[model samples]
Target: MNFFTIKTSWSNAEFILIKLCMASAYILIGSCFHDFFENHYSVLIGVFIITAIWFVYQWLKKMKSHSDIPY
Candidate 1:
């Protein structure tokens, strides 16, 4: 049940599914409010950039952890 540790296939699948759903929701909402986004394009771009960086950081961290395993 740990956030960072996906020990089972089912848990891993669920985690991926949830992440995808959240990402999709973000995109869908942004597109749905295209006019509002156009008015605040800079802010929206900044938020997306930050989110992308954070996602990359987490991916790298996960990769590093897995690489450290003895298997």
Candidate 2:
């Protein structure tokens, strides 16, 4: 629980930059493997997996910060 002792805050610009960087990495990977995701089903599955991962991350973060509240 005390693994990370340093607490740092990111500005809006920093958050935006981080998101842009992550998006760029995704785009680069997608372009490099264009053939693998050419089919509609593959694209759908990729989107679903990404959405599920994001949902889980948000749920965990919320639970950690607000343990008393049930969502």
What C-alpha RMSD separates each model from the true structure?
7.7, 10.8
User: What TM-score does candidate 1 reach?
Assistant: 0.50
Which stretches of model 2 miss by more than 4 angstroms? 1-38, 68-71
lDDT of 1 by residue, 41-71 (tens): 5555556666666656666666667665554
Q: Provide TM-scores for the models.
A: 0.50, 0.40
Pairs in clash, predicted candidate 1: none
